[model samples]
Target chain A: MTAVPNGHDGLITARGLYLSFGAIPALVDVDIDLWPGEVLAVVGESGSGKTTLLNVLSGRVAPDAGAVLYTDPEGEQHDVHTMPAPALRTLHRSDWGFVHQDPKQNLRMNVSAGGNVGERLMARGARHYGTIRAEAIDWLTQVEIDADRVDDLPRTFSGGMLQRLQIARTLVTHPRLVFMDEPTGGLDVSVQARLLDLIRTLVARLGIAAVLVTHDIAVARLLAHRIAVMQRGRVVETGLTDQVLDDPQHAYTQLLVSSVLQV
Target chain B: MIRTEGLAKTFTLHLRGGMQLPVFSGIDLTVHSGECVVLSGPSGAGKSTLMRSLYGNYRAGAGHIWIRHHGGMVDIAASEPRIVLAVRRETLVYVSQFLRVVPRVSTLDIVADEPITRGIAPDEARDMAGSLLLRLNIPRRMHGIPPATFSGGEQQRVNVARGFIAAHPILLLDEPTASLDAENRSVVVGMIQEAKARGTAVVAICHDADVRAAIADRLYPLSPAREAA
Candidate 1:
């Protein structure tokens, strides 16, 4: 909020956002700027409006007030809420990825893993099934899933493998910006560690910008370049991940960080 | 190569209802190239905090940290996170009291990662990393394992190896030899001397008096801020 980081506009910027679910405020005066290839984590306790903020930023949920501006590759900025539905859908299909906390929400369990991955490329206008299949296999490998498992149905995969398949399906499109809502959540600790490592490597290797929402401070510390601490639908503090985590400046941030003690 | 003016850090513990803990303030410090300045102070005198501030891990509440980065002076306090990270990668390097291990990253790759990111070839970087680890007495078998499984002394040695391998222009070491045996401590002392011989600006906080005596060109004593404030 204080420094604009040399004034190069972010790939996505949401300013002064306010949203309400009838009587309850879900988001209140939240502002965020995510630069290209930078991972920004939104961290707070449950009911901190983190998921609501992500939905609004990704154009899934419309905010009652404020603007979400997205700069396309051509340097043209699109007002996300004002954009036509079809155009925003195209953006979601091409330049943006949304990885849900539950892989089941993102993946079609009936589709084979390979079919799931290739479908995105097909949606992007790839007509040749062979090429799409090759790229799908390649992505499965990238996400550390075996290529031989390509034809297996999602129902056959373990929870961690399903998440990995979902990640492969999302990343097969090479979306420049990813919206990850607890990509490592809901798994055992060991599985979570592996998935986190995979996400870190993939995000770094591709230089994919991400806006990750997690209640886990350790996840933020592991994956984020910047951290925005939220409480009661408001950003209490925002800064470099190491700075905020190690030397928290806000009361809510301090509490959020101090809650996770070193084992 | 490193200069600070009125450098101060105060923590306002928000959970404690905004209780301000002044670590230090009103300080001026400087270290020229090829010099090793040891921060001599008792515990709780903000020695490690100063090291973290220099590395841009903590946002200083007041003052300027003018660092010679990429042949230009940049004040890290005023700079944004992007600029601060750039300064850290290209110019500044730090070895803290503990190794913050990334899960499953091999110890060799951990040390080699610094040079590899800074444009060295991976093969050459790993070779250099291997040699440094060997010199620091890390066994050959330990290189393939992550530092998470390493003992305190072993991990500290890996940290020492990593800090020296890149040969960055500015080095900040916080208790670099804290948990090591006398032999490894002396080995680290020798490495610090070698780093300084190459015109690197080193600022360290070493409580070991013998190690301090061997490497310190000047002792910059930090008085308790509680006394000064």
Candidate 2:
């Protein structure tokens, strides 16, 4: 596990971010700042532009306005929107990991678990399968997935197991920042609890900053340090998780907090 | 209502030397109307296989499945393939964890296809699809877009909408909320609960404890010993 860097300040800063799907504006003038070694939960109802914001941040979708300024490990700041292709690729390879809501969509269903974890390493030019397999096994163990299943294809894994595999695959490369969209969304309560525990431990041990997009307030309360509440394509509230969740100021936030069914 | 008598499925795996591998055997389960049952187990415990077998996705090697429908109780094992197909098309709905939208199909059309195929009027089917999307909080404009480009969560919602568009009495869901966030999970769960209240016999294979606790009236744990035969 990598140590959280001391005095690691803002790593990513987005100002006046705007995104649209054709003519329908998904996000409008959103601003966010993420520091190293902290978890920031982006919470919102469905169709609230929470995912659009993540897409812009991850470089999968470009913003229509404003700038996404990211600071690399070497302390160089680059405008993410206008960065050169090679530089962007390097940033993606060395600095960022993304976990989508559906593990099957993010994972290569036809390949072995080890192959998925080793893909990032292979992309960065690691050729020896022996070394890659070793690393993959280590990562699988780290994520609490059974190492014996390393040779099994993802199609055979259960939903919770698949999510864990996806996490191991993304984090094996040791990226500085990770973005997870609904990491524990559909998991059984036991599985959700286990996955959340694993994520909390891994993030703390590695000191990797993360942006987690979730609709579950409990998840945000458990894993996030700071929470940003979004609604109708805008940030309605932003504060510490406990404060935002327990004492939400906006009507939407209040409704979300109140709507949570205690099980 | 549905009942299984020592229901068993075993796949004969032909290895390089033609050796066979037994997948599962001698499984018994039942699902009653107005009830939601969750089947959970470790990965590769044959949860999906069992769910698929209920809808006849996999032909059982042995045992019998008796489905009690409005028409009558029919032995699924002894029924003709065409009869099973007709029953599945009209009365049973299966939602796989991964969205399986056909290429070039619009979201609206995907949801409306099953009902239309089953002879529901096109306009009524479209209305049903639209209402389902609205209930699930999917934006109205997205109805016309092809599901191919939608995000993972969005596509899953479309898939769920399509699966239940006809309000089939028997619904099988394999991790229906696997791609949903917390809010959407609740919405989908509520929808499922509504279906159960409407007397739909639902068997959901899930790994989420929260979902199971929220919706399942009964639970079954698939054992590895049972899966390995």
Candidate 3:
């Protein structure tokens, strides 16, 4: 297991972040930090601005106010909101991973499974075909696919397997930070269980810092070290997973907990 | 009530070629309706092995496990496989610490499978399973995805949902709270209490003192076998 951070390192810090679209606010005065080697889940109902916060923090959407800073491995702080486009793109390609909700959206449909994974490595300047293929196969096996199927097209794989392949492709590059938006969405219960297990193992083994956005409190409780609950584009509560979920202090959080759908 | 007499189990070490490793023997226990019985022991003791034997996952070396089924006592130890499966489906439920994965199956369907098989409408079963997953903290977005990539805590919740949704007459839980956080643990305690109130018989192994204190009616201790020491 990778050495977990001692709750000191701030990999990404956002201060007084504010954003709006066409006069309506999508995020309002939000501040948070992404720590190294920890999973942080941002949870809330749809249109509560959880996704907007993720996009802003990930530099996909620029905020109108506040500053978002990212600390590189060398401890140099870069202003994410104002960073040059090329440098920001480079940062995402080499140091970060993004997993979309749909596997088809995240994976390259035309590429072979191995090619999908190898492409990530190739972007970082891996030139040797034999070495890249070997690494890709190794990663495929790690995601629970047969090594022999490395040459097969992802279109032939099941939805669950496709998601696994996408994960392998994203993580094979050893990205330091991963942003996931409903990574387990669109799968059935049985497949989701196994897939969740796999994702947990990979996240821990890689020591990847993650910001996972989900509407499910259970997903937050399971995967996140800390949770930040958002409502109407503002954070209602933030704390360790157990504390926030078990003894929620905010009225909104309390309602969310008690309102958990029952069978 | 479900009762056992002289329940014993032994494993022949396949690699060691016929050497018998006896787990436990001469065990006597009874679990009555609305009661929770907890098995307590050290790591090497046969608590889990014995629990599995009672659930018919392992063949007991010697004993009679009488389970109340259809207004009669069925000897699970000597019953045919068909009878055992029927009892498992209709009367007994087992929740293990580690989830057994059914490849490419989503988390919702896994939890809903038992209830659906028991004649619940598919939509109702899915809804119930969805609610259970929500209660267990599984995300709604994950309702349709396969479970193979879920974290340990998530997978355990799926397992718990599957076992509880069955609402069988008897429950066998092995470390059901092993991977859960304090919040989810309390949820599990509530589920257990609800099951007991419905007159379900429960046998469980829990090392967490808080959970044990919350649900156990009595403690059954198991010790490692010592050959005539």
DockQ of predicted model 3: 0.03
Candidates sorted by lDDT, best first: 1, 3, 2
- Each prediction's TM-score versus the true structure: 0.96, 0.52, 0.55
What docking class should model 3 receive? Answer: incorrect
Q: Give per-residue lDDT, candidate 3, residue B154.
A: 89
The numbered model that scores best in DockQ is 1
Tens-digit per-residue lDDT, A63-138, candidate 1: 9999889998888898999999999999999999999999999899999999999998999999998999999999
Which candidate's lDDT is highest? 1
The sequence of per-residue lDDT tens digits that candidate 3 reaches over residues B159-221 is: 999999998999999999998999999999999999999999999999999999999999999
Worst 10 residues of 2 chain B by lDDT: B12-21
lDDT of 1 by residue, B1-229 (tens): 9999999999888777677789899779999999999998888988888889988899899999999998899998888777887888788998988888568889998899888767788899999999999999998999999899889999999999988987889999999999999999999999999989999999999888899999999998886677423
Could you tell which candidate, 2 or 3, scores higher by TM-score?
3
Root-mean-square deviation of Cα positions for candidate 3 versus the true structure, in angstroms: 20.1
Q: By lDDT, is 1 or 3 better?
A: 1
Q: What TM-score, to 2 decimals, does candidate 3 have? A: 0.55
Clashes (backbone N, CA, C under 3 Å), per candidate, total: 0, 7, 38
Which whole-number lDDT from 0 to 100 does residue A258 have in model 2? 76
Where does candidate 3 stray beyond 4 Å? Answer: A1-8, B1-229
**Per-residue alpha-carbon lDDT of candidate 2 for residues A142-192, written as tens digits (9 for 90 to 100):** 987889999999999999999999999888888889989999998887788
Candidate 1 total steric clashes? 0
Error of 1 at B171 (Å): 0.8
